[model samples]
Target chain A: MSEVKDTQGQLWEVFIQTKKGLPFKHFGSVHAYDKEMAIQNARDLYTRRGEGRGMWVVPADAIVAIDSSDDESFFDPSNDKVYRHPTFYELPDGLKNM
Target chain B: MDNLNLSKFCIRLGDHCLIMAHRQSELCSNGPFLEEDIAQINLGLDLLGQAEALLIYAAKLEGGTRTADDLAFRRPERQFHNFMLTEQPNTDFAFVIVRQYIMSLYLLKTYQALSKVEDDTLSGIALKALKELTYHERHFAMWLKRLGDGTEESHERTQTAINELWMFVGELYEEDEIDFMAQKASYAPTGIEMKTFLMEHITAKFSEATLETPHSIYMTTGSKKGIHTEYLGYLLTEMQYLQRAYPDAKW
Candidate 1:
């Protein structure tokens, strides 16, 4: 058994997919003793109303996240690149598939 | 099929769920861990839902002024047909999980059989219940393995629980005269057949848990006839307190 690290067992980040082929969006987090319990607890906490068709749970500690302090360094450079967006070009009114 | 027997059968199943769900629900704020507390509460709610559905079906088949509420609340101690095992006290978490494991195994077999039957309502309910029971069975089964093999105290506590609760397993297979009639009319499954699956699965799991198979020949009987341990009356007192105190109370 994993040592009881804290009152709320291991923190697991939960992601839920509403239907098949849908991307698993971050739903919330749950506390559980281990991987299976994490999935079960995630199911109970996140899927009570049948809101999910698929679920993924990862340990919160396993994630690698950029600090908020790095926001300027990571994403600020892309802000001025309006040409990278589809709206930069105007499409013909009759171009249905475009 | 005879309406009396069929309703009685439904009530029997309902009573088991109701009584056991009550036990599980009592742990709402008492679980060893927060996650476990929530998980068990969810399980209790699932059983409560299953009980209500079955009880409503029972009331419907009985075809009288008696509603599901009346059947569930107004009934006296002797009228309930839940197993003695279910009404047994939650001595500890190990016993609780052991009790759930036993009942879940029986319920899995029972509902699986029920899901295959012809009655639309019963089959539909069983099918729905099977989905929930899958997770419930897994939850307790994992607990059994965890507790049975974890620390020395956990292993000992759970091992004793298995032995203590093993006697109650016989009552689950104890068929009544009405049960025979129901089975003959294709209204119910042969419980003995269900026990075969339960025993096989239980033995394998128990062995994996490093627990000895209970070889004790002592078998506690007499729950289907509304006979139960001292636990049932006390359970009823708490369960029926609201209804008894305030008749027809509703949200």
Candidate 2:
């Protein structure tokens, strides 16, 4: 069982968008007891300029990020895969929404 | 009951915001961490922005030559009508949060009440400010719960902060001539209505935080009538120093 009680003061990863139709970007983290409070606290702390239409607060522990120490091995193969690029495809004349 | 009264009312409103903003601004560099420091300053800026808006309206109401800077800087400490809660020193993160938590709860209701004022200016101010206070209330409500229930040390510290600040809170809802004048002018909520609403609201949050409410004791009242704790003088000195030192000097 994931115990919230034992994980007090744990970090939360906050993502926010400055407005609707804007991409969510990393803003900041706050130490909170739960997801709801974390998001509210993030809104209070971050979106003062009407800078966000929405926010996402995920507990840092819940994020399974790839280890940065293994960055070269884990990400290098994908980086060199130019064949994965959409540039390989010729665009039609009216291919407006790339 | 004329524009003069309206001006005074708005100045009082601005004073509340400016004093609280200055106090919160003091937290920017000194928060427990970078994130909280940013959050505290965000609130501080919100309050200062609100003060500017209200003070401008107050100046117009007075039909005075003075600007917001004049009122904010030229007045002596005795003339400021802000609550002592806003003027108190930021003792610690817990202390600041507790004070804000309680004040947010009260201010949420205060603005809601103000929204019904007959004065268009007051109504507009209240409506817009209500939106800001909604988030403020939510943010601190969460902190109050987290700190209260997080750990033994956090709980005890938050509880102590709440108890110490409880005395200052009563002044927020304490009605006097100003409130009565507001009511008479159809520009304020009745004290009875505001009190009942705020108490029930605060009680629910306290219950959720799993903390016992401080017994209603030593709840001082009088800030609205210009009486304040000793701390107000020092805060005014800091806030008004620049303006006082160089009167009429423009940026």
Best by lDDT: 1
lDDT of 1 by residue, B1-251 (tens): 67777888899999989998999988988988777888899999999999999999999999976888898889999899898999888899999999999899888887887888788999998999999999999999888888988899999999988888889889877787877876786656687786788789899988888877888879988887777889899999999999999999988
Chain A: TM-score in each model = 0.80, 0.71
Reference-based lDDT, residue B223, model 2: 75
Report per-candidate DockQ.
Answer: 0.59, 0.38
Top of the candidates by DockQ: 1
Model 2 docking category: acceptable
lDDT of 2 by residue, B43-101 (tens): 78878888998899988888878888888998887788888888877887778888887
As a whole number from 0 to 100, the lDDT of residue B87 in candidate 2 is 84
Q: Who wins the TM-score comparison?
A: 1
The C-alpha RMSD in Å for every predicted model, in order, reads: 3.0, 4.3
Model 2 agreement with the true structure over A1-98: per-residue lDDT tens digits: 56555533668989997777767798877886567857766776777667778889988888888888999888778756677877777889987536
> What's the C-alpha lDDT at position A31 in model 1?
88
lDDT of 1 by residue, A1-98 (tens): 67754666779999999988778899989888789889988887889899998999999999999999999999878858777778867788987634
Clashing residue pairs, candidate 1? none
Per-residue lDDT of B92 in model 1: 96
**Interface RMSD, every prediction, one decimal place:** 1.4, 3.2
List the candidate 1 regions with Cα displacement exceeding 4 Å.
A1-8, A89-98
